[model samples]
Target chain A: METLFYIAAAVTLLATLRVITHVHAVHALLYLVVALIALSLIFYLLGAEFAAALEIIIYGGAIMVLFIFVVMLLGPLAVEQERTWLTPGAWVGPSILALVLLGEVGYLIVAGDLPAISIQEPRQKAVSIALFGPYIIGVELASMLLLPGLIGAYHLGRRLSSEAR
Target chain B: MSLQDLIVLTPILNLGIFCLVTMLAIAFRRNHARIAAFAFVACLLTLATLPWVASATPRAVTALLIVDRYALLYMGIVLCTTMMVIGLSYHYLHIQFRERDGIEEYYLLLLLATFGGLVLTVSVHFVSFFLGLELLGLSLCSLIGYVRTRRHPMEAAVKYLLLSISASAILLFGMALLYFESGSMTFRGVGMVVKQVQAVPGLWLGGVVLVFIGIALKLGLAPFHMWIPDVYQGAPAPITAYIATVSKGALVALLLRFVTDIGALELPSLVHLFSLLAVVSMVVGNVLALFQQNVKRLLAYSSIAHLGYLLVALLAGGPTAAEAVTFYVIVYCAMTLGSFGVVTAYSREAGDAEQFEDYRGLFWTRPWLAAMLALSLLSLAGIPVTAGFIGKFYAIAAGVDAGLWWLVLALIGNSVVSLYYYLRLVVTLFGDKPASATTPQGLAIESPQTSGWMAICSLGLVASIILIIGIYPEPLMELIRTSVSNLLMVAQQKP
Candidate 1:
């Protein structure tokens, strides 16, 4: 099980690197989706099934799809016409930061001091209860926040249709 | 059912009812501007209810939110700023849209965002904080692109969306790590874990750093401030005002509450990190502002510097520091609203007259608008006889009390650098210009003839309050002392 965890982590890291280096926006997004899915699978192996599920559902499925849709809508032609690489300074700074983080994570795993995964039955019911009980007000507040976005989108559609005339 | 509960939720209820009534008015009437005016009036009434509702007795409505004087004061600031922004929006959107199709939606978003900000000020759990922050963020994206007809607005919205998504993801990941380590999600629960746990290890520190990064991105501090200039320049003036005043104010309130409740002052490492960020933001923000030709971008960088100053008070980490931070937020909100109001009024007719040169001879042509703009700029530059000066003095005093001499020196240096650009705008407004040049394209050089009675009145009222507060700050100081005292008491309460 530990060996499998290491392999999955290695695969996730490789996929993330590819996502960053890919020239095409669509390719980058696809690589990101794969990296995220692999990362979630690793989480599942670590006994966080609920978190893994959310990772796949929200990040891999919903958010990645949004990115792909945007890229496609903007078209591959636009991507090809635009600059492929960001500023060298941007690449260098983030790379250095990422390396520092990677070193820290590596030190923890190597020291054998990382907390052992305590596999308990996933508390799916408890999570939902918490969401709807003490967290009900926050859920409602989030919905209110989204109300504006929905209204704004509707208004945009109406304006576009009228302008089509 | 309890008085404390009612006291905590009155402003939120007011906002809900305001949004509903405004929607009904919009459905019945074709006049977009009138609906906006009604909404503004509603916000004013809501602001009036806050002082009466704030309790001396602290209470929590649930495990999630605390009702105290601290939250009440911040809510009042949010509502008051929203009132001014709504009044400005009525004229600003009308001039931009020409034919109003969905102007009512803008007010709805503003109210919702204000509600979110109020929630953030009182939140005691990560769950509530995330919800509030996202609500504030999502509404802002829409508001930034409120003028969909323009290319720059759409571009700005897209940039804001992408960056905010990344920030939220980082924030969530940090929350996950924190929950895993502490075995809890509530602030108090985490504080207990921090106290009992023997060794924190690297993952814990990483999570804390990621959380700070996410917050820094939202605050538009240096290193994470790339989005501010573009978004501020592209968005409609009223929306920009909302982003500057309410959004940033709410974040400060939340940070203060989180630190106080979680006993972050005990952590020397965290204090060091915040102090470093404060110094960097002050120097970088001021230097960037000195070179900006666009007025909106200038203010954006200035805001970054202002946030650094607020951080000085926050890092001071005493009851006095908390009082100073609250007082500074109130004064900052008033000054920013008035400045943005001037921009909205003049620029609506001048078609995004944000360029420094666009304001040449403004004092000769439109003395009232120019004068208000001058006063606001002076206030922002920390001139004597303005609220900005009093706020800065308080912040410096708090920093001195905390022995943050280095931060005080950095803040003073930045204030000096900021004065040059702020006065440039003032000089341009009163300077002489050639009379033969045709108006620049996309520049709204000519002031509109319409009677902007309400907008002007709101600006005048806020400016006068700023002046009064600057001259005699004892009243506001006392109020702030009461609020901070109440906050500390609630924070010390055992769960």
Candidate 2:
């Protein structure tokens, strides 16, 4: 189980890196799906079965499909723009920064006195109760937050008619 | 929530319901002036509920929000600032959009953003914090880019959206780590764990540092301030004022609550980190402002410096610090709004009158606006006879009381350094019109009848408040002291 966990984590990290470096939006999104799936596997290994399932279903499956649909809708123009933006020179700076972050994370994991937080397989019923009871305000506020996000997306995406100008 | 909880939350609920109502109103009919007035009245109604809310002082409505005088005070500031922003937006959108353009959504987004700010002031849990922050952030992204016809606002919006999301992610990660360390998500619960701990654990310290860094980025502190000038320059002037005042003020209020609740300032490392950020922001913000040709960008840098001065009060960590910070935020909002109000009044269909050259010889033409702009600049410079001087004096006094001598000196020196650019702009406002200087028709004076007088009245009110606070700060100080004491009582009782 430990070895499998390490493999999944490594795969997630590699796929995430590919997602970042990929020039094509579709290709990057495919890599992102792979990363999400591997992340779900890690969650399963950690005994968070509900989280694993939700990660796979929501993040890996649904979000990826939506992203791919949008990429296709945007067509190949975004790919050309990405090519212009993701020049080899751009990679060097970000790669260096990522390396620095990697080193810092590695050091913290090795040296820091992190809390030994034991993971429990959270029951689905318990999660639901918490969501509806103690966290109902959060759930409501999250929905409220989505309203402006939807409005913003629609407002920005709408084409202005000549008369409007 | 119970009936009492619901009643205590009246102010936030009023704004929330009004946000939805504004949305419905826009769907029904799209009169720009009517909708602006609606938003204004909605904010006024919310402000009116504060006295009723005061009757239910220091009540924790669930684990998520606290209804106290502190929250109420900041809520009042946020609502008033939102109203002023709405007033300025009325005239701004009036000029920026024609009859056929759908500009009503700007008011919807503004109200929603203000709703988010109000939520932020009362939040005690990470869940509420993240929700409120994102709501404010996402709404602001749209508000910044509301004019899609322009390239800069869109670019600015995209920049802000990406950076803001990144910051939010960092903040979430920090919260998760802290939750891991302490097994708590509520500020009071975390405060209890911190109080009981002997030596600060590394993970907890890292989490606290990351959270502060995330907030500093949002606040446009020194190292994370790269985005401010561009966003300020690209956004509509009124929205820029909103971002500067309401958005930043909400975050400051939240940060103070979080720090006070957790007793985070007692950690030596955190104090050192804050001091470093304060000095750097002061030096970098003022020094950069000295070279700005654009008035908007100059104000952007000045805001950075002003927030740096604000951090000193935060670090002082007492009832006095709380009072000082509250007073400083109010004064800052008033002056910033007044300054941006002048810009919005002068802005035309082409773009905002952001260039320093635009205000040149303004005293010769449109003396009223020139005077308002000059007074705002003088106030921003912390000159005597302006509210800003008193704000700065309070900040320095707080810092000195806390034995933050170096920070106080840095703040005082930066105030002197800041004077040059502010005075430079003031000079430009009063300078002779060059023989070759052609007054663009956009810069030409508009009749008060066509241009909304609501904006002018709001500006006049703001300027007078600044002067009033400068001359007689006793009443405001008394109010701030009471509110701070109320907030401190809650913090003390929690542990």
Candidate 3:
């Protein structure tokens, strides 16, 4: 199980790197969907089955499709457009920094001083009770957060469509 | 959940419902004036409910929110400032937008932003804080770019959105780290860990510093202040006022709560870090302000310095810290809104009258607006006879009491350095009009429109408040003392 978790984590990291480095938006979206799926696999390995399912369903499936649609709507990019900005200088520094971070994290895990994850699969009933009980205000506040977000999106989108006309 | 909880939550509840109702009213019929009037009245009603909410006295409505005098005081300030913004936005939008354009949604976004600020003041849990911050941020993105046809506002909106998203990500990561260390999300839970522990972990300190960096970026402190000038310059005038005041003020309140809860001042490392941020922010903010040609950008830099001064009070953490911070925030909001309100009043159909050239001889042309702007600039400079002076005095006093000599000196020096540009603008207001200068398009000199009058009256109200507080600070100080006591009591009770 631990080996599988590592495998999933490696796949997720590779997919994320591809998503960041890919020149084309469509390819990036595909890689991002792959990363999300691998992330859900890691979640499942951690015993958060509900979160894993939700992650795949909401992020990997629904959001990926939306992203693809938006990219399609934006049309094809000029071939060298992003390449001009994505020179080696841009990625080299960040990649080296990321490598250092990865090494540090790997060292910490191998040191075996950190506590192991307690794998408790949260029941759907328990999740609902927690969400509706003490966290109910947060739920309500989240709704408020989405309300303006939707309005603002629709507002900006309407203006864009009108401008296109 | 319970009757008392609902009652304690009335101020937020009332505003939240009004936001929805206002949205519906716009959908039912998009009458700009009617909707603006409805939002203004809704905010007024929310302000009215605060006293009742206060009567419920220090109730934890949920694990997420704690309604106390500290939250209520900031809420009152937020609501009042929003009302002023709504009033100022009315004519500005009316003249800016065509009749076919939907201006009513601006009010909806404005009210939602206010609701977000209100939620932030009372948030005790990370969930509520993140939600509130996002709500405010998302709404602000649209509001900043409401003039979508213009390129600058759009660019400004995108800049603010990208930077703000990164900052929020850092904040979330910090919260996750802190939760990992303490196994808790509530402020009180973290406070308990801090209280019980003998030696603090490095992970916890890392989380705290990351969180402060995120918030300092939001507050536009020195090193993290790249976005302020562009965002401030590009946003519409009234919305600029909103960003400068309510958005940042709520964060200050939250920072105070978190710092006090953890007894962060007791740690020398944190004290040194804060003092460093304070001094750098003051010097950087003031120094940058010295060269700004645009009024909005100038105020933007001045605001950075002002926040740095506020950090001195925050660093001075003791019985007087919260009071000093609160008083300074109120004074900051009043002066900021007053100056931005003047900008809104004089803003033309083309764009905001942000250039120093636009204000040249403004006193000769428009005395009332000029006087208000002059007074606000004086306050921003911490000149005598304005609330900014008294606010600075309190901050200095708190710093002295805490023995933060260098931070206090930096603050005083920055205030002196800040006066050059502020007075430069004041001189521009009274300076000679150029012979070649054409009447800048739509200079608000045609006639006294009703909406314009309403905007001017609000500016007058802000100016009067500044003077009243400056001249008679005792009553305001008394109020702030009580509120700070309530805050300290709550912080103590948590552990």
Docking class of 1: acceptable
lDDT of 3 by residue, B1-495 (tens): 889999998999999999999988998998988999999999999999998778887988778999999999999999999999998999899888764477889999999999999999999888998899898999999999888877889899999999889999999888988998988998778767767889988898888888888888888888899999999999999999999999999989999998888778888999989888888889988898899999999999999899999999989887798999999999999999999999888887777889898888888778888999999999988888889999999999999998989888888888889989999999999998655435655453542333376797799899999999989999988888888799999888833
C-alpha lDDT of all candidate models, in order = 0.80, 0.87, 0.86
Write model 1 residue lDDT over B94-141, tens digit each, in one string: 787766666777887787788788889888888889988988898888
Candidate with top DockQ is 2
As a whole number from 0 to 100, the lDDT of residue B342 in candidate 1 is 81
* Runs with alpha carbons beyond 4 Å of true place in candidate 1: A6-44, A48-118, A156-158, A161-165, B1-7, B20-30, B197-201, B436-439, B442-445
Error of 3 at A2 (Å): 3.4
Model 1 over residues A1-165: C-alpha lDDT tens digits?
Answer: 576578667767876897788776655665576677768767866778788899989997886668656756767575663344344633553354345435544655687553367577448898898778777777777667667667667765565532666
TM-score of each: 0.86, 0.92, 0.91
Give, for candidate 1 chain B, the lowest lDDT window spanning 10 residues: B442-451
The numbered model that scores best in lDDT is 2
lDDT of 3 by residue, A71-138 (tens): 45655673354455456754554355345435544754687443245477668899999999989988
- The DockQ-based CAPRI class assigned to model 3 is acceptable
DockQ of each: 0.34, 0.53, 0.45
lDDT of 2 by residue, B1-495 (tens): 899989999998898999899999999998887888999999999999998889788899778999899999999999999988888888778777764577988988998999999999999999999899999999999999998777899999988998898899899989988998999999888777778879888998888888888899899999999999999999999999999999999999999999999899888998999999999999999999999999999999999999999999888988889989999999999999989889888787778889887888888877889899999999999998999999998998999998998999999999999999999999999898755425656444432323478888888889899999999999999988988899899999943
